[model samples]
Target chain A: MASTDTFTDIRGCPSGARPLHRPRRRVPREPPASSFPTRSGDFGTGARTRTGTGARLRNPAERARRQWAVSGWAGLSVVCRPGVGGMAQSRGMTSIKATSGGESAVRVRGLVKHYGSTKALDGVDLDVRQGTVLGVLGPNGAGKTTLVRVLSTLVQPDAGTAMVAGYDVLTQPRQLRRVIGLTGQYASVDEKLSGRENLYMIGRLLDLSRKDARRRAEEMLERFSLTEAAKRPAAQYSGGMRRRLDLAASMVGHPAVLYLDEPTTGLDPRTRNEVWREVRRMVGDGSTVLLTTQYMEEAEQLADELTVVDRGRVIAEGRVDELKARIGGRTLRIRPTDGHRPAEMAEALAASPVTGVGGATADVEDGTVTVPIVDDDQLTAVVRLLAERGFGIAEIGTSLPSLDEVFLAVTGQKASVPQDPRPAADNSDDLEGAAV
Target chain B: MSTATITPPAAVRGARSEGRIGLRANLRHISALVRRNALQIKQDPESMFDALLMPIIFTLLFVYVFGGAISGKGHQAAYVNYVVPGLMAMMGMNIAQAVGTGINDDFKKGVMDRFRTMPIARSSVLIAKIVVEIGRMLVATAILLGMGFALGMTVHTDVLHLLAAVVLSLVFGASLMWIFILLGLTMKTAQSVQGVAMLVLMPLQFGSSIFAPTTTMPGWLQSFTDVNPLSNLADASRALVNGGAVAHSVWMTLAWAIGITAVTAPLAVMRFRKKA
Candidate 1:
């Protein structure tokens, strides 16, 4: 049966196709109290209740739209509103697009897969709206790659369902494969073929005409800045170049949805930024992206909404700012003068009326005393109390919690580098060794 | 880069129908994959070393080492005509084994994942590998025929008969590949695929009539050779080129080809689908 159930255009075009240079339209904002549920109900109650409601909806598209509406509104109201923070204001434009009720490009619910005795994906649920990136953040062996593999139809899930771009991953894999592109964790380019040949081969396999395939190959090679090495074998290319080629190969078909499984895992900062730029450009061109990464910076730089997964389950899901905010608002870091000890300062701050009754705890680490402050009043009160106590502050600053801190708060464990027993033989040794 | 100016083609933008790949598109996909595998061989010429060298070494060793012993003192030239056609069967079996190793190596690399995720028909990948290996087998047969001629062996029948003999070997060779392809898909690594293939190939190669006539063998061994597909292939090619009663052996070889393919092709596809 020809099912168009998942076919919803982001631009609201009835035909599901849009012109290349059409003027961009502002996302239609839904009222906070109408379509969206309470923010705390969606994110604060943990992954189980949220996933339970999502699973109860029989239609995956309906479930995806509902979940997207909830998370999208939460992300927008928390980050896009004016006067929130300089960081949120700077990112407000992207979050606005993220909040649109665009069709879900990928809808996965109650996904479960087991490899032998280990559960690779334990009842995971995710939704990615058109023209936005949903970052699946997890540590190694956290089922990130398995989720990507299952959604891309490379691996079948043991149970549950996934629908991508109007095609069910299990029943309609061929149709799903037509609209989705996957750049796996390992670069999947043909090593023996030249860069140009690799792209051309993929173009042809994607059902492009021979002339179009050749033209698309040239266009992708030029776009990725691989024209200089177009004729060289991919095996001879550097790690970054091979990754670019793999990305280019996946893009030759201009798939409506792209899955990037750790696209910049071992890349240097320069290459990582290049990948991020490519991802943004694709999103700007009206393609939905589901990016899986272990790097917080990568997720922060690309994902409009983040889904934190660990040990085969979704631990937390929201905007990056919301996740950080959930841990607790900005932290007040105080470094006392060289003569005073941070431990004594922390003890005094903890005992003071300003911080004691509010339940904001103060802790000392590496010569700095940090207090989690909920508002500007707490910040001012702490500063006044410190001055009244005759404390000499050498350095003081208020900073938002890093993703590392948020990860620790949620997973209750640091996102440590996974213990890979193999030597770093795959790529450039510079950043890979540092990453390990 | 400004991808804003670049849009996907109209075919991609439109509502994609739930269409199965037609025969024409499947043929195109198979040809494209075949070109890819052929290009790999072109880039790494050493991959074809066995196909080129094995026939030459085997032809010389069998002709000189066992010619007089097997065919009697003054009849070495007769043995040349006898063993050369039989060696064609051997060439087919050896070249077919490479298909399994090549597929296992692709599985080890990330390229297999790419193939699996593409919208093309899954059988296209295996068919392309078989096509390229069959091409390699033809090349080895040509080299074996040339070596046989250089060693003073002559074809008694017309070139049509000699060509038929070569085609028969390839038909049998292509069918044998599905078995090895199954081994490649099920085995963990290329080394293990080779190890298991060798274990299966040794007895089949020795017990068959590819090296000597089955008439001189023990009764029980002859009974085994009566049913061995390799022996049927060797006997068929011997009759086709040396001008003998060709109907029985030729029909038996074709039947074995159909039977092996019928059993193994579906099994290989099932294994390929479940491999990940």
Candidate 2:
């Protein structure tokens, strides 16, 4: 389906099939945006099955169990992205009260922007509450940056309107600029200036008096822990320090709404935590935040509400735990002491109570059987039956669904690896120190 | 949840306090922007080198290489007196190009986004850019004229006429600045800005009566050179400094300055608004 979407451009171009023989120029080498090779199942065999690492859909009962994952709804786990069919054209300001039941600090309605033929943003509607963090999560080219740019008044939207901090982005941009601060993906400070000088420059640009600007510069330096290196040029600062300074520069004006676009993309774990701590402190000060991130862990750590966006639309949105539950239930992993999983479901099903739970499905890989059970009682039943059936249990643990699993279940694509986005570790000093 | 007013920090509180800024406060912001850009240039020695070195190199090449031929052979003073005004006009245009490429760099690095979100006057950035260009022109003019004096370029008019010549060059530079702003905001890259500078400014500088008077050129070339704003600016400066009749060129230069500005200022601002 993903390949056929591009058939006309390559084969039917004015140059014809000759271009097909050449390597595709614009095809991203990294299997970008929405490409998942091993997600589909066999249509030839009558029984449905999902094919991936450790997934075996041979038996009829086993295939039926995996069918539970095949959406009772749109069911786009294997191939297509969510919201390709269900995206609403407009959810005007009235939808805010209906959806969130409160006034949002930032409200977006049917925001659409296209770059050439690619729709970078397609009718995206979202709401971030006052004094709360809304994490916008998506893969590469998912319009996360576009949404941030629109809200921050940096990039104009081709269609629809966005209201940030009670000011319309189009008509009241100057007022909105006063009420919001933006920290983009790249740090935009003057490399020639010292950290203290950079903050002072921003303070003055914000129209603070000389005395106030000087005091604010000192205050920000202390806040970001850059006092030791405050006199050094920002070009010489470490990646973490520079990121902190970029964040600190944005907070100089005390913006009511702050837009952080992938704030911790290249930071080490410790530095990322430092940035997270500052964000928490800002929220404590009653500032609403719109944070965009690739790491589900970061979203889980920071976002009060999560909006999982894929291909320019929100696919799933809820608290982390709620999103996990909606996508899939908690999973149970048990490893037998005899160094083997019970190969056949028949032995455990007829003699034991493992099949009692309606939607429970188990896949045994590497001598560990992982079961997605509906609730705790079913978990207890599965545990008791595993030992009772003489499957000597070496390890027994219940693992709640993580945001990573939720992302995969909803988007159908594996989460891109977060650490070390670049091969050369030259600009950022602490990539090796990234632990969280 | 119901909530009370959230306390803002010092800078934001200042922005909220400003209902309508008076002219004095607006000037303050304009001056602040000018000062910030001055500091940026001060820190960048390469900018200083370009400002000081480029004018001297061009002046020496024109005066030494063409001074003998433009005048009779080995006649330095006549050509020096004749060509300094033209070099100053070129200096003004180069300073204008600096504004163009500098603004382009600001846009590419996303620094313009930071400034657009500030509560200061929107016109202050443009005003500061013009002010900085004038400053560069003055410095480059001083260096170029000092070299001209050493090579025996004499000032026939009093200090008042000389100061007026300086003012005239600045006005023309400011006019070119509005056009540069349009070019800077419209183009996507700094390299494109340079490309435009070569295309538009190179002909304006070299095709005018800087090295030779209009009579020396062919009839077809003379037609375009007659109305070229650079020609009028160079002619006005020449008449004021070298003791020629000043009426015709001075009025033409002022008209070009005002006309170019009237046409380009709003257009540049509109383009900048769209780009922002």
Candidate 3:
């Protein structure tokens, strides 16, 4: 499960330090008063302090204090600083380390591929360090699969260049293929062949001797938990079983780099977790992975870094935590007790110096007041203010923005729902891109 | 799933630094794919329906229904000898079309992507399919000849000549496969491949001397049959099995086989390379 808490101190803070405020009496619901905008304004400025450079200059110590608050968080230390150029420079430095290190497993530059008039990959660039998963996060028709295909040498790029495991995708495709394994979105296995046969055949094609191929097939079956169904035709296997078999087939060569293009796109949660575990095991065994997925949770769970692509371009690239922080820090949610109007709580918090300046706003539908908190002190301030005002608090928790929220904030459009019925068009675009 | 501790296999460890697959490895890969195709056929017997049933139905229908009219009313037995060898050519044409549909289906299944990504000869994938289809053609030929022998169709020539005719049909069948394989590599779907194959097969089957002598046809039709590779194969097999002039048709069949293969094999390979 993805951890909702982004702030380590807040999650581990003692509850006794911030007493819970229980409602003594019910308050009538009233139409929000005209004072709501003024309250929202006070909190909005406090929220803007982290993003506004003028506010940072007003208090030189404020930057150092906020840095201490976020420094403990992985991948968020440098990014949390409040300058566009500084953040951009830090991101560049990280990628430079990723690309320049001798451990870079796959490097791509200006990989442009056009299918008819549609540019499937328009000047795409990427760098994945060795033994780490670089999750290519994208929605459908975003050219994530095209990038995988080009890097795997299954499709030739019209222009640009890519090197996987030190071999050029175009000039050294044959040698590149010897070191990379690709598992396509669809389970590309021989449906009529038994699971064992599929793995054995791949093994033999990889230049293994007959005896070694058999041994490798058996070993893979056991490792992937497909030993029980080794003799059954893959066509008879369930969806998850076939996916496991397909994954096992790719692993037969023990490739140095594995490209999994949406490996768990439609799998149930249990099977998805199983796939995640298998990926972790592979990475543990020193195989670098380039995983493409639309599920933000999958990326957050497995990727060391993520490259968010939209319409054949990289919109954002960073570690998962860094991407979340790029949008904003943690949000505090305060739910009022039953019949206690949330608007009143928002009004009260808006007048206070601490909670009032942090952009607290009431959502009537959820009956909660949300505040964007820059530090743990704001949360404690809100709790103390609510208790002093005798307002009943039903629930209180601070959570980092979900990746879904980050995706929306960065792309300016909602990520397509996983179960959206528009897959037909998306799939045709994918097939066209692949077929070319 | 339990974390089953697994050490990487020796083959995988040793293969990490391996270069492009050599000729020996290519042959091995082709043979493995051939075994895979054979296994798939065994598992799904329906895939062999055309090969197994087409020969039987065509042999019986052509020998009994058209035998009387084509060989003269009272000498149907002569038609059996004439039609049975010609059916070999028909079987070859029909089964070769199946190669196209089979390859098209493989492409749709996305397994071709898996093969393309592997460190193996690209031609091995197509060669294995052709090898299996040729095996299927041979099976259909045996069934056709078995039905012919049961119907009082005699090989008037020696057994060596009969063997030579069977070998000739296999060669012609194998060569014809490249054309269909090219179709498979280029067509958008299996149904389109089948539809276009039927259009090609119809003219080559009916316009040739398979069911009736080309000498009695119209002038224009005779010219087509004379140049038709299927016609050459039928005429050569007929001469070898029933004892007739063999040189012209046999040499023509070999030349057509060589020409079709020479023209189509490279095209098919090039198409396969570019398809993805």
Put down candidate 2 lDDT per residue, A1-436, tens digits, no spaces: 1221122111111111121112212221122332122222211111111211112112233233223222221321232221221121112223224445335889898899887887778788888877567889888788899888888776799899899867898887767777788887543776667898888888777667777778888888997899999988777999889888888889888788898999999889889888877776665455678999988877766676678777776666654444544555445555556644445432453345555443333344445455655444665677666656666765544443556766765564653222222211221221222111
Q: What is candidate 1's lDDT per residue for A321-427, written digit by digit as tens? A: 54554454555666688788877778788788774324433344356676765455776678788888888886565444556665655564653322112211211
What is the TM-score of each predicted model, taking all chains together?
Answer: 0.79, 0.76, 0.80
Off by over 4 Å in 3: A2-89, A92-102, A333-350, A355-357, A361-369, A375-398, A414-436, B1-18
Ranking by DockQ: 1, 3, 2
Q: Look at candidate 3 and give me any clashing residue pairs.
A: A43-A357, A43-A359
TM-score of 2: 0.76
Clashing pairs in 1: none
What is the interface RMSD, in angstroms, for predicted model 3?
7.2
Error of 3 at A168 (Å): 0.7
**What TM value does chain B of candidate 3 have?**
0.93
Worst 10 residues of 2 chain B by lDDT: B1-10
Model no. 1, DockQ? 0.37
Candidate 2 Cα outliers beyond 4 Å, as residue runs: A1-102, A333-351, A354-369, A379-398, A412-436, B1-25
Q: Best candidate, DockQ-wise? A: 1
* Best by the TM-score measure: 3
What is candidate 3's lDDT per residue for B1-276, written digit by digit as tens?
211333344344356455656678789999999999999999989988988899889978887788888887878888989999999988988898988988889888988889988888899999999899989988999989998999899989999999899989988988899999999888999999999999988988999999999889999989998898888899999999999999999999999889889999999989988887
| Model 3 error, position A192 (Å) | 1.2
Error of 2 at A329 (Å): 1.0
